[model samples]
Target: MTLHRFAFPTAIHFGAGARKGVADHLRQAGCRRPLIVTDRALAALPVLAEFRSHLDGLEVAVFDGVFGNPTASQVMAGAQAFKQHRADSLIGFGGGAALDVAKVVGVMAVHEGHVLEYVWDHPQVRPIVHPLPHFVALPTTAGTGSEVGRSSVVSEDDTHVKRIVFSPQLLARAVFADPELTLGLPPAVTAATGMDALTHNVESYLSPAYHPLCDGIALEGTRIAARSLRTAVAEPGDLAARGDMLMASMMGAIAFQKDLGAVHACAHALGAVCDLHHGLANALMIDTVLAWNFEAVPHKFDELAHVCGLAGGGQAFVPWLRQLKADIGISGGLAQRGVRREQLPRLVELALADICHQTNPRPCTAADFERFFEAAL
Candidate 1:
């Protein structure tokens, strides 16, 4: 029998058209004026109007200033927009970046100071001990599961240093996970994002932690991804496959309360230093990290192989990961993605500084990251 110490606090309603009830849920949360925080690209889509249709009397405000790898400035602007609209709640509607900004925006709206003040880092700041606006997360994509996460990743605009602001206060009051919205995603985006979910599942499982509860969820999440991610990529119209991936993505977020590993460390650094897509960076780096990680936790690889439905244990995992990426049309190393060779040093520096990687199965020194980058290169 398996058990869990953590319970996902967000009320979840999962189905094909679950997003249609967002307004009712907001009302249940006692929110009147709601701000929908999303990205500019999504704001232009017809879906935006449909999302607002259900909120007829809510006096909805649209703040579409979210950006890729959400910047600190974007969070500030969103907070300003929320206050300007006198919004009572927030609807995080889009991909990971949009959801992350919404979480931070919810925090900033009621806080006394700067958005950066709450970051989970040194020059230590006060913990977020206050209540936040009621928030509803509606993910348009199947990856990033940011809708269910309790933290937001924001970057310093110029330096591109990623910082996480964590608080149970940031968790959405409700999550409307509707895979129907992902039916029109481009194949490449689907593939990349699916890999991000896989990385999350795998890393959380492998992270050196004692949470058997989280370990169980991580393994199950991987199984879900293994069964459905490729199908979702090949047949974007397959709602069932999309739903599985979305569930796996959300499970990854929940399970990763156990924390992530080196793949994320590398991906975050790559995103900050190279401005790469979060999913794509994780996709490209996963195999390299896995290969390095296998020796340290060989038994975990066996467990992963069984859960991921691979025929062979241990020895087969890394190769399968590479093959899976290739099958999804993701090939080559970091160099292929226009990441200059000279950037490796900077990426390593960023990776070492990333707090998220601290729980990696094997303690990673800066040298380990350099070698990891070299392998990817």
Candidate 2:
């Protein structure tokens, strides 16, 4: 078994109608006026309507400018909105992009400097110094697990490279994980996001870091996603399935702070290079990267197979993942998703530079990344 230190960072309020008490929770946290950070797409969806109804007339300002892969400019804009509204806190409400922007917004609100100056692996990066505005997250999607995480992935405007901004202070003060908010998700969103949760679990477990608690949570998260994702995708209205996937997503998020592996490196590159949906990109590249990594850590795959209910052991997990994605309608590899053959060099460069791959069970070289990308294609 692996060994490491662990801590539960986010206070969680879970169950049906959980979003109803957002105002009370915010008030208790000393937030009288919070800027609700979300995407333009979800500003007035039925889920947001229900959330507003739960607030029972407590007024809140909203910045709904975040759309798909949040950029540094969006975070800066959200911070400006937070200041303009005289908002004392932030509520990250919507999908991963919204939540990501919200987290960084809270950082930018209190700290002086450009958001990129605090990016995780950047040279010339500055340290966070101020206490952030209180933040509460109510995730509308079960994927990305950004609600419980301490990091946000933001794309750079000029290069479009995805940079992870990490700080323990970015963790939400509380999370209202209501599965009811997820019921309205379309089938494609549901499938892709669920698979993202699965990738987190599998990659975290396979990472060469020693974190037994994370390993345990990773296995259970994998189990939850395997059993619940298909049901949630097919029946969209199944609260039980939705809730399980939600829990699994949260678990994956917490577990992966021990860090991820080649899959995420590749996924991050795909997002940067192609502007593809993060989860869908993970769904496409997961099998290819993990297969490349299988020879180095076969035992982890064997354990993964056992947890996911596959008949075969280590060798079976990759095929099972590939089929699982196919069965749920996540189509094709990198090329099918619009990555050109000529772009392989850039993708490989991005993937190799990504710090996420440092803990990969197998050291990924440029040649290996080319083969993996080729295999994915």
Q: How close is every model to the real structure, measured as TM-score?
A: 0.97, 0.97
Total clashing residue pairs per candidate?
0, 0
lDDT digits (tens) for residues 1-377 of candidate 1: 65545666678999999998987777876889999999999999988888788787688889999867899999999999999999999999999999999999988888878778788784868677678888999998877899999989999888988888988888888899999888878999999989988888899999887787778889999999998988998888999999999999998988898999989999999998889999999999998888888989999999999987788788898998888888888999889888887998899899998877899888899999999988888
Give candidate 1's whole-model lDDT: 0.89
lDDT for residue 43 in candidate 2, whole number 0-100: 91
Per-residue error for 242 in candidate 2, Å, reads: 0.7
- Tens digits of lDDT, candidate 2, 1-377: 54456788679999988887788887777778888999988996776766776665456888999997899999999999999999898999998999999999998998888999999777988888888998999999998999999999899989999888998989999999999999999999999999889889888999878888898999999999999998999999999999999999999998998799988998898889989888898898898888888889888889999998888798999888878887888877777778999998999999999898999999989998889889889
State the TM-score for model 2.
Answer: 0.97
Candidate 1 TM-score versus the reference: 0.97
What's the lDDT for all of these models?
Answer: 0.89, 0.89
Candidate 2: C-alpha lDDT: 0.89
